[model samples]
Target: MTVIDLVAQADGADPLETEPLYHAIDPDLLDSLPDADGFSRLEFSYQGYTVSVTDGTDGVEISLAETGVSVDGSSGDLIDTEFST
Candidate 1:
């Protein structure tokens, strides 16, 4: 799952360079995410990208790890809620 998540946004050639999931999220949260609902928004950073998994967003959202940068690199916060997952 971690590799899938990393590769989903990684530069492909360097996806393996991303940090392991264990270093990105807590084990407890990671363990419970598979059962998480869309009502919940869980986010974290892997390597230099942001990873977001919302209850109903279908899948995770990954982007460059920059402040005030939206998924499209617009001038707004990509995520409104703090990291809770």
Candidate 2:
């Protein structure tokens, strides 16, 4: 999937005022396949906040470095944490 796709998935969790800067693995490597089937990390710059998402076999983790907060979820509500800059 493209970076935009990751961002879209994340954004769908909640409506936020922060703008997102999306980045993803290059989508042009037709001959190449990732070692993993899911996303490893998704990061974006919203307003001044840097948000990141990491997925593991067991679950997904979301973090906001600027707020020094993080959330981990396997399935359920979207975890929201606010870091203190």
Candidate 3:
């Protein structure tokens, strides 16, 4: 499945005690991400609600407060957490 699809499915769940599903993707491939910049505005299903990753100058960030599943970016890291739904 595509990254978006995987993220959407994972996000649609209860936030309480939900463990963040980590998906490590190649950074090189991320450079070709189609909606990289637009992802911030796109909401995905998270904890029975729609949430979006906020794209910052450095990179993308996703946080499920209750679940403690925070996804962040790293510079030049070979393996990076792509999404947490």
Overall lDDT per candidate, in order of appearance? 0.52, 0.41, 0.42
**Candidate 3 lDDT over residue span 22-82, tens digit each:** 3233434443444554554444444332344466666654432223333442223232324
Query: Which of 1 and 3 is the better model by lDDT?
Result: 1
Among all windows of 10 consecutive residues in model 1, the one with the lowest summed lDDT is 76-85
Candidate 2 C-alpha lDDT tens digits along 1-85: 2333333444454334323333222334311333447557666554333556566445555455332233231234334544321
TM per prediction = 0.47, 0.34, 0.28
Query: Tens-digit lDDT track for model 1 on 1-85?
Result: 5534444444455555555667767756755765766446666765445666655455443333334553455676443332321
Question: Which of the numbered candidates is closest to the native, going by highest TM-score?
Answer: 1
lDDT for model 2 comes to: 0.41
Error of 2 at 65 (Å): 1.5
Q: Is candidate 2 or candidate 3 better by TM-score?
A: 2
TM-score, predicted candidate 1 vs. hidden true structure? 0.47
